[model samples]
Target: MESVRTCVGCRARASRSSLLRVVAIDSALIPDERAAIPGRGAWVHPTLECAETAIRRRAFVRALRVSGSPDAQTLIDHLQRNG
Candidate 1:
């Protein structure tokens, strides 16, 4: 079946294929290119604004069920590379 997920940043719902999956691994936020990584994952658009908003709103940890500040370096780099 087709997968649909809501972006934690903009709270916009989009197909899983269209939205990027950010997974929490080793207490860091890493972009899941194939969306196959196990563990808590949150969906978001591949835009910096959404990322920043998600961070600002403190949505990542909640969405991913992680504690402490998550290292979003990978996610940031991914957005930079895509943008």
Candidate 2:
């Protein structure tokens, strides 16, 4: 069976390999290309809407336990560039 992860935006459970994993690094959002980042990570659908919703709602901050330095736009841009 495939590993599963929950999308922080929609709260939908999906295959871990199917969702995109994003991690905050140096106050920037970077794609977890290998899904091996040590810090907290957030999962989202590869679609624009889900990415936008996650940013608009600040889901990453909550899920990742980040505070005062969450870069929502950077994350959105990363998702757009990578999606």
Indicate which candidate wins on lDDT: 1
| Candidate 1, 1-83: lDDT as tens digits | 89889999999989889889999888889999898988788999989999999998999989999989999988999899997
For model 2 the local lDDT of residue 50 reads 81
Residue-wise lDDT of candidate 2 within 1-83, one digit each (tens)?
89899887788999998898888877666667678989888898876788778877878777777775566666667667877
C-alpha lDDT (0 to 100) for residue 28 of candidate 2: 66
Model 2: which residue pairs collide? none
- Runs with alpha carbons beyond 4 Å of true place in candidate 1: none
The parts of candidate 2 lying over 4 Å away from their true place are none
TM-score winner among the candidates? Answer: 1
What TM-score does each of the candidates earn?
A: 0.93, 0.81
Q: What is the lDDT of residue 71 in candidate 2?
A: 62
